[model samples]
Target: MTEVDPLALDLPVLASLAGSAADEFLLARLRADGHEHIRRSHGYVFQRLIAGAPTVTELGAALGVTQQAASKAVIELEQLGYVERSADAADSRIRRIALTDRGREVVQLGRRLRAELEQTLLATVDPADAAAARRVLVALLAASGGLEAIAGRSVPLPSD
Candidate 1:
């Protein structure tokens, strides 16, 4: 059996490295494709929109940003023609933000880029190890209740 050095390896180090690697991987792929205007934070918003939710203030609360900031981002994206703002169909007085064809294209492309990255990250691992990682990840997220909070509207994140 190989001896493991506990001092040389730690969870914190691995977690930090994993985050940095993921960020670098994403930005490298997306930025190369001329997606410099999209920020990492926009991923959350995109996913939320995909799930059929639309509202700048709600997105702001979930992202821990002010409504004004969220609205600004929406405006910029709208100007880029990726998103559209219109009167809510159900409520004429309220406004809703939706992904235009350009927005959906960006989201789909983002998904493909992320999937490719994930495949490379797990490429060398044994199938059993990969299955275990998936199970552990699911369990950890479920236990943490992070997704549950965000799954519904007006959920919150840590305020900056």
Candidate 2:
């Protein structure tokens, strides 16, 4: 039997680790800014809401979660003042979920924090190298049929 090299992780594993690190950084900064109630999972909801208000069912479909689960999350976010549910303009029979002002602030903060993270990385990594890394990541995402999701800023939750 040959010993496996710990440094030779698969691309998915490496990507997940990098994403987790970035999320942690963003969360910490948000906490400092009084958004301690925000959680990483809320990102999926925010991504979909960014385009427009969506029904709970639509949100669940976008998140790849059960409607019940999506509703539960929305309820939690509503209580935290990050989101609100209102009657749909077209049909009062249906309700739509929208981000609150607090939610928008967190989203804007996250974008700025991500830009800062990139700048921090560039401080140590050459700009060309960073560009190449981005290209590689984009290519990987495209190959996995996720480019559209990225373009739409919608990321589904991972299946259990």
Top TM-score hit: 2
Residue pairs clashing, model 1: none
TM-score for each model? 0.77, 0.89
lDDT scores in order? 0.74, 0.89
lDDT of 1 by residue, 1-80 (tens): 99976568664555446666887788778878877777766666676677675788877776678999889878888887
The C-alpha local distance difference test score for the whole of candidate 1 amounts to: 0.74
Tens-place lDDT per residue, model 2, 16-78, is 788888889889899898988888888888989989999999999889889999999999999
Q: Residue 73 in model 2: shift from native, Å?
A: 0.8
The superposed Cα distance between candidate 1 and the true structure at residue 20, in angstroms, equals: 3.1
